[model samples]
Target: MVTITVTRKSQSFVAPSELTPSEMLELSAIDRVPGLRHTVRSLHVFRHKDAADRVASRPAEVIRAALSRALVDYRPFAGRFVGSVVAGETCVECTNDGAWFVEAVADCSLDDMNGLDYPLMVSEEELLPAPEEGVDPTSIPVMMQVTEFACGGFVVGLIAVHTLADGLGAAQFINAISELARGMDKPTVTPVWARGLIPNPPKLPLGPPPSFQSFGFGHFAMDVTSDRIAHVKAEYFQATGQYCSAFDVAIAKVWQARTRAVRYNPEVEVHVCFFANTRHLLTQVLPKDGGFYGNCFYPVTVTATAGDLAVAGLLDVIRMIRDGKARLPLEFAKWTSGDVKVDPYELTFEHNVLFVSDWTRLGFLEADYGWGAPSHIIPFTYADYMAVAVLGAPPVPKKGTRIMTQCVEEKHLMDFKDEMKALF
Candidate 1:
């Protein structure tokens, strides 16, 4: 086993290089959802490269300077989340508080950790930054750590509160930092903070905020190769006479296989919830140029009985997922207009709910900070819920998607693996 040691060199706050607005910024209803109150964490791994100059070899200094510039436009990220007088609402107090930054050094190279691939060998605590024991995580909207390895390679770990942005929006913020690090004056696509454009929900009764709870799930990484996905897509098209996306087939297979492996009671209700991007759906309100950096995706859930999922054909499962995604526009409208009473953030694990997040199109790999694009991008840790992360595999000749899942218990883990293997 390879043991990697990381030492912290410095810790400080990175405020915006230029002065930003000092006012309260009201977050959209989607941003203030109770479920998204937690922090989102990720790690970006970059390989060692020969540099022309000494200053260019240091990634920490370059990123620190670039992050300061990036915060000028994304000022909301530097602010803290404050509760609103209105029930079930939170807003960002843009006090220019600044983001937390850490510089660290790792004693090993990427190769020592298997190219920083799936089944991450290093501890998340070593790579990601965290708040002190008494500090509230939400008070720091963003925290970043850059850990350079002995071989000159580095890893960038980030933690951002979900209320500030979703996967795409967060990627936009990081990309801006990358642009500035690469000597660009500004980001390619300017960010827009049109939070009010998303209609607010009518005043609703406030409830106790949700807390994180772990179910002791055995986490596993399942790689679905491109060839396997292609074969499944072909089979689906032949059976349904309709085309389906890679995500549709992949998620359907996992949901079906998991339901069967868990052996839930026939009458037990099972649900698979995934977020659908509303950028195109809300083009009238959001910019089409991809500048709206906020939480614009909403959850769409497909529910069925365990017995039905176990017996249903793959094509049928895919159709159910398709139908669920198709309802995003209407469901989002109802949610915004106060017609739907269901709180999207009030999630239940109960071993029956699967929350799948697709990060394949989030543009995390494009964050090239002078060295080059990162070779791999992965979440720092899985959520306590039965979470499934669909991420793009590391850059390789044979491309594939890595599905990191934490749903099955230890006893049923082998059965779940077998079921997934038999599908391909």
Candidate 2:
């Protein structure tokens, strides 16, 4: 494992022309040219365990470096780097607020934030919700904010534009930085755009997309909240009584039940897309240490039905998701991993309602920024029926484990709660 040291690198400012091809690619990645709201999607929040103690970690320094590099090209476009203008993007500076952020840097990691107090869990309504105001054409690609916390650990807030990549992609970058912070000579993976290898967006036929007004101008979107996380982690078992991962079994049973209900789509084919971390996939194979720049993880897209997800066994669901990952290099993986490799006008398709697997997919949840691990990590709440995930909480003496989830609507959410109680 190779990691870069933040302390060793000069906090130097370099023009884009001065950068290597790879560096330039990274710089360009942040440009908020219109149509790439993902370039500004706000996903992922980071927590430091011991506040001040983890500040010196090389990973933290590297993150700062990356930010500086991004600014070289995507510097504040008239006050902000880039974002949905209709929604009003701004680097809203703040000493403190309830916004959920990726990084929360503060001058002092206060002592009062010890345990539950600092990692405050409020109602879901109070958490960061997706922008309701027309995806704010000017929504800042990066919303930088810092504040003092009761705990010694300072929080750094970074909200990436969601159109570019999802939460899974953001997590990969963070983990890579952690590797560097630990002083690894080489990073785990190198990012590759590989755009040339894929097809253009809308590869064939298509239709007119909904106008901005059709999306309710992004105002009707609900806000995400911080309801305390709760879940149960268990291993999968076969009929022979052999044990498997709880995630595998849970996914299997849920989707399996759904598969039995709906007739599988023959033309488009219904499947589950599991987003896996690809940082280690290619990087681990390298002999030298280096930074992997482009987004690496390949989305796992397994075909199934709504009924399949609702009634499949844990092991089966895990198997389906894992299998999709195993075949990333396949043509199918490229078409549906959320990359607009094919133009939407041609396919008339978008990832229709993502059923995300949150709890067991990502490793390093125990990422200790020196203070200690986080008490919890919740899923994005801005997306309606489409974006859903089951989050896991840290172990508490009495609670053991817990899970978080999003539903299609209020009724489905309540139904799920009922199902969970009956099953558990």
Candidate 3:
């Protein structure tokens, strides 16, 4: 196992320059509807290279300057959350309050860290900026940490308020920072904050519904190689005479394996929820270029019983997921303020739920700062939910996807590992 020694260097705020817009940015209905109070966290690891002498020597100064410039365009991130729970609207105020930024040093080299089969979760957290004090973290909206390793490599950890952006939205923000760092004029896709584009929902209930309450779950990770994914897709095609997407197959397998791993009784209910991208699905409302940033995906959920899943074949599961995804357009069409009555965020993570987020298509590998594209992108943590993050690997020998998951039961963890390996 690789060990990491992290030393926090500086803790400060990075505010936008006078050039960027200065005003309060309100949360859209999509952001406030679920009343979810958590940040979506991500990590990007860059390997040390002799060529990256500039980045390694002054990592903090370079990143801090770039972040300040980037914040000028993404000023909402520099703002703090102002509205209260009882106020009915919680908005982000762009007072140029600044995002919490941290700099750190790690003990091991990039190879030493990646040498392990699974990335170190403990070290990943250390690379993230500490949560803000005095005010709600969401107010800060975005927090970041850049940690340089002994071998010249470094990792960047980010925690963004989900109310602001989903995976893609967050990627867009990072890409902008990267572009500025690389001396580009601006991001290729300028962020669009047409919050009204997302239909507003009626006043939400006070807290997460009873069914959405947290359950003690142990987190774990399972690696899925390109070969394994291809094998499953081939199996699906042969069995059903129809093609299946990598995501459809990978998610189905995890759902099936996890259901069986836990040894749930045949009649026990189970659910699989996917965060489906709606940028294309809602073209009528969204820009064709899909340049509009903010949360644009909807959670598409399918439910079953342990017995039902046990009896179902792989094709059956794929079809189920397909159908659920196909319904997003209709869901959006029928959406209204009253739709909050069935808030998807609550349904997205109801107890015992298997929530899968596919980041393979999100272009994380292209997230290049001045140094170069990240060698590895890892999701460090998820709040109050058991999640499986499917990420795309960098351009390398293996050319595949990596599945990192939050904890489940101990026995189930072993079973899931064995089951995933057997798929190949």
Best by lDDT: 1
Residues 17-89 of candidate 1 have per-residue lDDT tens digits of 9999899988887887766777888888898765565344489999999999999999988888889523546
lDDT of 2 by residue, 1-424 (tens): 1221111112122222223222221212212212334433222234444445446543334444444343322222112232243232312221111112233233223233233231343222222333334644334433432222433333333455643334544454545444444445434555433323322223233335433311110111111112211122233333324444444434443344333322234344455444454445444332234332333344455675555455556555666666665676554334434454443212112333335455434433544333444444444333432434443444222232344443334424444444444434
Candidate number that wins on TM-score, 2 or 3 = 3
The candidate maximizing TM-score is 1
Ranking by TM-score: 1, 3, 2
Please say which candidate is ahead in lDDT: 2 or 3.
Answer: 3
Which whole-number lDDT from 0 to 100 does residue 84 have in model 3?
67
Candidate 2 positional error at 36, Å: 6.8
| Worst ten in a row by lDDT for model 2 | 214-223
| lDDT value, residue 318 of candidate 3 | 84
Per-model TM values vs. the true structure: 0.94, 0.53, 0.89
Report the lDDT of model 2 for residue 342: 47
Model 2 residue 239 lDDT score: 38
